[model samples]
Target: MKALRISAMALLGALLALTSFFVGMGVGVRQVPVPKAIPAATPTPVPTPETGVDFSVFWEAWGILEREFYGEIPPAEERMYSAIRGVISSLGDPYTSFLDPKQASVARQDITGSFEGIGAIVDMKEGKLVIVEVIEGQPAEKAGLKSGDIILKVDDKPIENMTLLEAVLLIRGPKGTPVKLTVYREGLEEPFEVTIIRQRIEIPTLSYKMLDGKIAYIKLREFNEIASEKLKEALRELIPQKPVGIILDLRGNPGGLLSVAVEVASQFVDKSPILIERTKSGQEKLFKAVPGGLATDPSIPLVVLVNGASASASEIVAGAIRDHGRGILLGEKTFGKGSVQQPFTLKDGSELRVTTARWFTPSGTAIHGKGLTPDIEVKAGEGEKDVQLEKAVEYILGLRREGKSDVCEGCGKQP
Candidate 1:
């Protein structure tokens, strides 16, 4: 019942829908920050009287497979891990998932915002692993990987039936290792292979620049550990420039740490209870804005950009901004992913990521599967004209002259 470390709505962003384990939501097709400091609790066996479920049938099937199956058996650990996955999957919740030690390690490192993999964001579309977004200047782009490229195989092995985690494991390797990807381009009739040398990718948590109108343009890519730190750095550099307004872009952000989300929201929303966490039992908790915020000034005027993929911690920040009227929520409705995940590490270092709670905006609107609606909806896609951004800029420039707009009914309400 305690506040979870990974996210109140974090790790389930990417992997649950088969798009989560890429090494690039800050890094990986992402979800869930593994709270490393959490001591691994020893596994407790459920008493037969507690559940009253038959266990003999599982053993009987295992014995049959071991005795009569023609193929060699995997290690007992693999079988056990697979069973754990089955147990979690039976819950019928995509966010509730299990990761082996290696996958768990990758997820933990994702919080640090760097990992060893071909840099790209991938999604499972129609049962095929497709390359959605490749990190620029990284191995994926360097190897001529393009968006919409369908990956058929990794290192000559077809990725058929492999989970996103499994496929990501194949694509990820130690730095300097080579990974061969058989790709099927939309225009190309034949599937071709591209060998990429995996390297240490420093996922950019954010990038900020002073726009032409002297506005601060900050694009947040993830809520990794260093996100707030990087934002502080950006503020120190940009605030002095005296920008007319700020544009905090959260498009394509897949979410990360829950604590980091609160910290990021604190930068703009100078109010208590930046977010709310509600367990299934209807118990509620609050995450308040912390002190020492660098951008809590009400006159600065803010606008946030979000799209369908803006999830978890992304929705947290966007929701806070809208609830407090700290910014105009522009772009389409956000990726509705307001559920919190608690990562439980086992003795063998595997992790069980369970959906433990649901989170809401400061105003108490649920975000899970029902994304935040934009105050001003503008649709835009990647590589196209950024009409949303242009609209945001125009709106902010107008706000500077007209003063605070009643963008939200709860605008400036200390609710």
Candidate 2:
């Protein structure tokens, strides 16, 4: 089954399944346009409960505004959009949101990973806009945009009350245009401004190299459609060298398609349940690993690296590897985001992304709002080298020296 899994920023935080593109770093597959508008179905009115509550007041206000409002009132369709936004906002779910026709069109481009923007992933946290990931070789990275920088303004406009999508709209523009951003960084008393030239960004999926001449180190930037295939190709090239172990780095990865996550986990796990999905009605569905994975051999020692930015599909893969004892998890706690969202197109060509279910690890641990904790907690210092990666490499080399095969008791065991 093709499950729709997403995080916050389509290319950044949450996942939008339309084109399965990366948000923050700007990577993904081909784009697919939103479906054509369908005819509106007849409404089936429900009888009001006997609780004595009346919704007639809403209609009365609408009628009064239509009759006596001084300024030019918006079209009925435009007003309907506001009404829908109000209703969805009442749910108090940041993930469940409405995208208007224009926004919906941009979302399609976002998931496909090609757009005119600074190429940085960002999200709203506690009313503040925060950078999640900066795409390598992109304008954001070239401008020295770093993860964790809190955005204070866009184009000199205060972003205090703007939604993440609002700020995104302001930040992105025609290619070669400049967008100015003011951000607050830790240890700095005052905020600073940075001008970035927007350009067409194409995000790369994975990067790998052999470490210590024996261990294969693969860094998965995002879980896009081609992630698993790229990983398989990387393994094909690395396995011939007979590496002692493998380190899968998932730091700063937001999330993407659910099906892609399953494919990624299958590469490391053999014939085991990867994750379980629980719907609102309490129906449970199991996602198991498929046969013929590139790295399913239990004898190969494995390690996974994660951080606060690793979420959704990334968490699924990390949680499976840890729960099945196939590898060791090392890094900071993951970004807790476990809910699933499905998109429903409206008659106006807009879209509604609604949260429908929650996902659990193989051991039945709920990941929604509660991120996974790594077995070995390693922190990376600010402006310092990647200490966590170095630690993973050290651990894997030690296992190789000990002549260990399959799994190490201190790290993980074979399933």
Candidate 3:
């Protein structure tokens, strides 16, 4: 079986679409590079079984088009690439996609979290480009872009029939330049226009502060490369303060590297299985927690905050903590994105990102298309304060008062 690998530089809904892979490690804002001409290589013949249908019709059509078509015939290599894409599309799995050389390069930039754009995460839902999140302190947030805003147009051009990558390319531009967007918000009767100047966005992974009640508040924005290290630093600083509880905020975080997910979960879950991976061949692999975690002390109460936008690596960590009785999950159901994607680089520098496996919580709950439900489901009303965070704080304080640090066994069991 192929090894499961996550994109090293995936963005969370900041580039094209708000799907798990798109936000976690697939989309980015860098301009696609020009395709370079390469030396032709020998074609590998397709092997057909004795009972398989003949593929002569396809070749016949290609031959006829080359000989008699009036229009300029595309190169055979280009046509082959299109055929490969069509084959992948037949799988009906959006996460399994073919990226041209240019697209692959752009994807690499996405996970790096340094690009020139409005810095808003977006997703394609019901044929519309919807905003999933706005990176805080970025141009999109400063310009008042909010989640659930449907993008109708870019720069006065309607985005009809355009793919997420195409829309992303149009929205991203050089720094200090303005990109106009028309969006339809949930409460508004009509679509409105917002012009935002693009800038180089460098997304911060994590932040921590001591709250009023001696509770440490740590907001993890993404499960990128620096996430684990930053978390360790935060624990080093705040744990010494002897905080009674810890509130981990994973709301609106799209996921990134899978290894980073395990590292993040290890911080709270002591020597236990953080995640389980089941491949196509029915082989199960366990990702166990490493020792010497900074926050593995079971006496420290932990509360994790999640929402509809929390996905992939976010769900992994949340589910692990909840399963191990390490923390209580608060807020809404997570964005169910449990499949693993591994990118295979083709000879021509393009990539085929294929789904290789599905991950489950230690308690054996599958999270694909069905997200993790929170222990305390606190829904936030429109224009309302963060009732979820407040509830987490309240729960932590109550636990402190009761002299309880861990949730009871079998609490918030998987349905």
| Tens-digit per-residue lDDT, 1-415, candidate 1 | 2224332111111221222433322111123445554563334333366577566667778889999999889987799788878887778776677888887777666676677778877755556777766777888888898877888998789986555666677777788888888999988879899888888877766899999889899998777778889999999999999888999998777777778888899888888888888889999988888798888787788889988767778888888887887777888887677777777777677877677788888888877767888878898855767899999999888877777642556443222
Tens digits of per-residue lDDT for model 2 on 140-237? 88888888888898889998765566567677777888888898999899999999888877666788999874899999877666678889999999
Q: After superposition, how far is residue 331 of candidate 2 from its true place, in Å?
A: 0.4
Tell me each candidate's TM-score. Answer: 0.87, 0.87, 0.87
Instruction: Estimate, for each residue in 1-415, the C-alpha lDDT of model 3 and write its tens digit.
Output: 2223432112322472223323343211112233344455433244357636456667777789899999898888789878978898799876787778866666555555466778877666666777777777888888888888888999999986555555666777678999999989989889999999988877776888999899999998766557788899999999999999999998877677677788888889885788888899999988889777888888998989988878788888899999888888889998888877776767778877777788889989998889898888899766757788788888889988898885855564765
- What is the overall TM-score of model 2 with all chains considered together? 0.87
The number of clashing residue pairs in model 1 is: 13
Top candidate (lDDT): 3
Model 3 — TM-score against the truth? 0.87
What do the candidate models score in CA lDDT, each in turn? 0.72, 0.73, 0.73
